[model samples]
Target chain A: MSAPKTTRAWILSNPPTDMPDESTFKLVEQDLSELKDGEVLVKTTYLSNDPAQRGWIQKGVIADRMYFPPVEINAPMSSFGIATVIESKAADFPKGTLVNCLTNWREYAVIDTTLGAPYVTRVDPIPGFKETHFLGALGLTGVTAYHGLENVNVTKDDTVVVSGAAGATGSMVVQIAKKIIGCKRVVGIAGTADKCKWVESLGADVCINYRDADFKEQLIKQTEGYVEVYFDNVGGEILDLMLARVKRFGRVSACGSISEYNNSSPPGFKNWFEVIANRITIKGLIVLDAGARWPEMIKEISEAAVSGKIQVGDANETIVPTAFEDVPKTWLKLFEGANTGKLITHIV
Target chain B: MSAPKTTRAWILSNPPTDMPDESTFKLVEQDLSELKDGEVLVKTTYLSNDPAQRGWIQKGVIADRMYFPPVEINAPMSSFGIATVIESKAADFPKGTLVNCLTNWREYAVIDTTLGAPYVTRVDPIPGFKETHFLGALGLTGVTAYHGLENVNVTKDDTVVVSGAAGATGSMVVQIAKKIIGCKRVVGIAGTADKCKWVESLGADVCINYRDADFKEQLIKQTEGYVEVYFDNVGGEILDLMLARVKRFGRVSACGSISEYNNSSPPGFKNWFEVIANRITIKGLIVLDAGARWPEMIKEISEAAVSGKIQVGDANETIVPTAFEDVPKTWLKLFEGANTGKLITHIV
Candidate 1:
C-alpha cells in the first residue's frame, strides 16, 4: 500500500494546570510531507497510555526538568507505540514490517530510523506471545519493575510491599517479587476490590484495598509486623503509611507518584522521621536512566514469559480499541482508575 | 581515695511534652552500694551532652521504639561520660584508670564492666590530645561523622552540604568531608555568624547562616547550583530546602533531627517528591549501627588527628565546668544552639 496523502494528528493545545481533559489537546488534519531517503512511512497500530504522560503535559519547573523534554505546546504529543511500515526507504524497515518506535498521536507518520535510539526501535514478534506484550510486560513497564527492585538489592528473605499493584509497573513488580525473586511475602495495595483480587492473582500473597477503612491495620496484620522493602508506585498518604511500617534498615524504591501527579500541592510526609529512627534507605527511579541495560532485562522477562513463570496474558492487560476521534477520552481513563493492568489503545 | 558513702544523682522526674527544662529532673542523694566482683566504683569526671538525649526521653512510640530503652521516669538519665576508677574488683579496670562508659547523672556510681559493650569501654588517651577529644572528635560524635559520610558513600568528586555544621557531629562531618575525604566543595549550615566562622575554620569551603534571609539564594549561589551529598543533622524545614537543592542521584545522610525533637508535630517534608524527580537516595544513620566498624573508623580518625589532618583540640570543643546542681540546665543549651562544637560538662 502507498503512503496516505493526509493524516490526522493530535497536538498539545495547552498544558494542564491539573489533570488533562479533552480541551488539553487539539486535533487537526495535516498534509503529509514526502519521506526522506532514510525514513519510513508507517501507520499507527497501537498506542501506549501511561501515567507519566500527565507529567509531560504539566507546567513549570517539574515539566521542564523531567528526564526527557516536555512535549512542546501545539506539537504532536509523543509516547511509545507500535506501527506497521507501509512504505520505506531504509533497508532495515521493509514494507509491512511491524516496529515499535516513538510514535505521535497520528494516523500516519514518517520515522527516521537513522536517528537511532529514543526514536525508532525494531521489535520482533515472538511466537505464542501477543504483540501487545512488547508494550506491557516486555516493554518499559516490565523493565521499570525489574530494575527498580534490583536497584534496592531486594533479597529472597525480604517481605516486600508494593503500592499501585494493579497498575502496569506495579503488576509487573508484584509478579517479579514473588515469582522470580521469591520474596518471603509480597503484599500489594490497589484502589478497588477487583483490582486487589487481580493483583493477588498475579502471584501477590495478599492485596489490600487502599480505600478500605482498615487498610493500615490490614497491612500491619498481613505483613506480620514490618516490611523489608517497599516498591512505591503511588505516592502521597500511602507512602507515609508505608514509611511508618518499614523495618529498620529497610529499603524504598520510589518508582512513581501517580497519586500526586495532578495535585498542585500533594500531602507532605509527616512520618519522614521514621527514616532517621529506622535507618531506612530510599532511592527514586526513572526507568529511562537504565537504557543501556534494557536488553538484559528484556531477555530475562521474555524467558520468564515463555516458561509461564510470569503471566503476560490478557488478564495482565487492558487493551481498549479506540476510534480515531476518541483517543484523548480513552487516555483520560488512566487517571480515573477505570482500567486494570497495563492500559493500551488499539487504533481502529 | 575511698568510695563515698553517699552519692548525689539527678533522675528524670517526668517526661517533657516539649523541650526538657530544669523541672524535668529532680536531684536526690542516694546511699551507695558496695562494688561486687567484676565491678568498679568510679567518679564522674566529664559528661557528654548530645541532642540524641532528647530522643531518649521522648514519650510514646518514638521513645518506645528507640535503639535503646528510654530513660524511665524517676530513673537517672544516661549519656556517654568519662570516669576515673577509684575502687575496683574487676581485673581489667584498675584504680586511677580513665575509661569511657554510659553513665547516669551522678557524682559517684558503680559499674559492672562484665556487662561489656554499651556499658563500658576502655579509652587510652593519646599524647597531646585532650581527654575531651574522646567526647567530641574521637568519640561517638566523631565516629558519627565518619560513618555517616561513609554510609552514604560520599566521594572526592562530591559537593557536600552539612546542616548544623557547628554542632558536635556536624563539626566532625565538616572536617572529614573536607580534610579527610577531600570532597570537591563542602558547604555548611549554621544558625549564627560566629558558628559559621567556626565551621569555616574547620575546613568548610563556606558556611551559610540559616538565619540569613537569603540563605536559600546563598546556598544555590555558593554551591554553583546543586549539591551531590547532604549530611542532615537538623531536620524539619532545612531538610526540605536541601532536598530541593540536591542534584540527580544525590545522597542524604539522615543523621539527626534536632530541630524537630521538641515539636509534637514536626513540619512535614513538602519537597519529598523531589526524591523521585531527582532520583535521590536518602539513608538515615544511627552511629550505633556501625559499632562493628568503629575500631577501623577510630583508627583512621586517630591517624588523621595525630597527623594534624583532623582538628580534635579545644578549638573543636566547648567544655563547660558545670556545677553539680547545673547539669540539666547545661544540656538544654543544645536545643538553643547555644554551644558550639562538642558540649562537654566538666563535673568538678
Candidate 2:
C-alpha cells in the first residue's frame, strides 16, 4: 500500500491571548515521512482536547516547569490522541489494530513507539461506546480521577468538593466519587452556569458556578458543614477558599491547578494558616505515580461502564471533526469555554 | 495532715516586653482550698519550661488560638507542670505517689485528675537521669518528635531536614531520626552558632544557622541532593526555604511554626507552587493525635538514650527546686533564650 504524500495538522503560530483565539494556531499541510525500521505508522482516530493542553502551548514559566518544548513555528503540535496502527514493524503491536496512541494532532504520523514517551496500548473496543471514550473515561483523565479519590481515601461520609467539576478529570471525579464511594454529598464548582448543570447531571449533589458574584458566600452556605475532602482541580482563589472550610483532619488532593496555569503572575493564598490550624493533609499527585495501579483502575472503570453505573456523557456526542488544520481553532474554542465534554478530531 | 495556711505562686501581672523582667510577674501568698472527691492535691515537683509555653504567654496564642484566660487582676496564674501526688482521695493515685501532673503555678494545687489531660504515669524514680527528661526526651516534646517522624514515614534512605534543631522538639527529632531510621543524612537549622554545634553533636550531619544572611543559599547547598523529609518546628521563612528544596514526593510534618507564632503579621511563602510541581505532602500534627502510641514512642526514645546513640544537649540541663513563686521568673528566662536544653523546677 502506498502512503499519502501530504498530511494535515495544526501549528501554534502565536501564543494565546487573555482568552485564546483562533489566530493563536494556524492549520497547515506537511509531507509525510516514511516509517523507519523499528517504527510504526499510525493515523489519528481521536484527538483529545483537554484544559491542560492550553497550558502546554503558553509561553511562560510554570510552577513545575511543565512546559512542552516550545511548540515550534509551523510544526504539527503534539497531544494525546487515539490512533489506529496502520502499519508496524514492532513485535508487540500488529497492523490494523485499534490502539490508543498519544501523538501529535495530525492525520498521519510515523512513531518509534520503543523510544517515545507517549505510551501506545491496544484498544479492545467495548460495545455501545465510541472510540473517543478511550480519550476520556477509559484514558488518562479517568485514571487521574480514580487515583485522586483513592489516594485521598475518599469514603461515603466524605463531603467532597471538586473544583473544575465540569472538566474531564473533575467530571470523572464527581461520577466516580458519587457512584463508587457513595459520598454523602458531592459538590462541584465550575466556571459557567451550563457547566454547573452538567456537573449536577454527573450525580453531583450540589454544583456552584465560580463565576457567580457571591460565589464564596454561596459556597460556604452550601457546604455549611466543614469540608472533609477537597479534590482540587482549579487552584488559586478556589483553593484558598476551600482551605478555610476544611475540617480538622481533612484531606486535600492537589490534582491540578488549571486556574493558575495561565496567570501572568504567581498567585498566592493569604490564609494558608488554615493548613496548620485544622491539621489538614495536602498531597500533590501526578498520574505517572499511579501507573503502578492503572490496570486495576482500568478494570474497575470498565466494569463500572459495562454495568451502566458510570455514565461517560454520550458516545455519539461528536464535535464537528475539526480538520488537523483546525487544531488551533478547536483549542481556542476550549479556552473560550465553548466546548462541553471532550473535543476530538477525526483524521481523514 | 495539716496543709500550709499560705501557698506561694507566681502571677503574670502584665504582658512583658522583648524579654520578661522579674517585676512583670508578681509573687503572692494565698490560702489553700479544700480538695473534693475524685481530686488529688499535688505539690509542684518538675515545672517544665518549654518554648511553646513562651509562645503561649508572650503572644496569648497557642496553636493559632488565644491561650490565656484573663489574669483576674491579682490571682495566681495556672500552667502545665509535673507534680507529686502529696494527698489524694482518688483510688488509682494515692498520697506520696510520684505522678506527672498538670497544675497551676502555685506551691500546691487541688486537681481533679479526671478533668486533666494525663502527661505521664507513675514511674519508679524515673532512673538516675534527670527527672526533667520526663519533660523533654521522655515527655511531650519527645513524643511530638516521635509522632512527626513516624507519621511522615522517614526512612533510612531519606534525607531528613529539621528546623529548630537545638530546641526541645527539634533536638529530639534529630536524634530520633539519626538513631532509629539510620537516615542517609540529617540536616538541622538552628538560631545560634552554639545551638548549631549542639545539633551537630546530636548527630546532625550538617547544622546551619538561620540567622546568617545567606541562610537560604546555605540551606540549598547543604541539601545538595533533595530533601525527602522535613520536620518543620519553626515555620516562617525557614520553612519556606526548606520547601523550595524538597524533592518530588517529599513529606513535611509541620510540628510547629515558632517563628510566626510571635509575629503580629506573619510572612508567607511565595513559592508554594513547589507543593504541586514536586508532588510534596504537607501534614500538620499535634502529638495528642498519637495518643495510644505514647508508650511506644517513650520506649524508642528511652532505648536510644540508654544505648548512647542520642545525646540530649546540656545548655538548659540545670534542675533547681524553687518555691512556686519562681516559675514566672524562670519562664521569663525561656522567653529571653537564656535557658537551654530542658529547664525544670523541682518542688522541695
True contacts kept of each: 0.61, 0.35
Q: Score the docking of each candidate (DockQ).
A: 0.48, 0.23
Chain B TM-score of candidate number 2: 0.85
Query: Which ten residues in a row are the worst by lDDT in model 1 chain B?
Result: B59-68
What is the lDDT for B150 in model 2?
A: 85
Highest lDDT model number:
1
Candidate 1 per-residue lDDT over residues B38-96, each given as its tens digit: 98888899999998888777765455246667888888888788999999999999998
Q: Where does model 1 exceed 4 Å of error?
A: A1-33, A62-65, A115-119, A291-293, A321-329, B1-32, B62-65, B115-119, B321-326
**Best prediction by TM-score:** 1
B28-71, model 2: which lDDT tens digit per residue?
77777777888877877777766555443452332333223434
Binned by DockQ into CAPRI classes (incorrect, acceptable, medium, high), candidate 2 is: acceptable
Instruction: Say what the interface RMSD of candidate 2 is.
Output: 3.8
How closely does chain A match the true chain A in each prediction, as TM-score? 0.96, 0.88
Report every candidate's CA lDDT: 0.86, 0.73
Model 1 lDDT tens row, A221-284: 8866688999999888898889888898899999988888877666656576688878999999
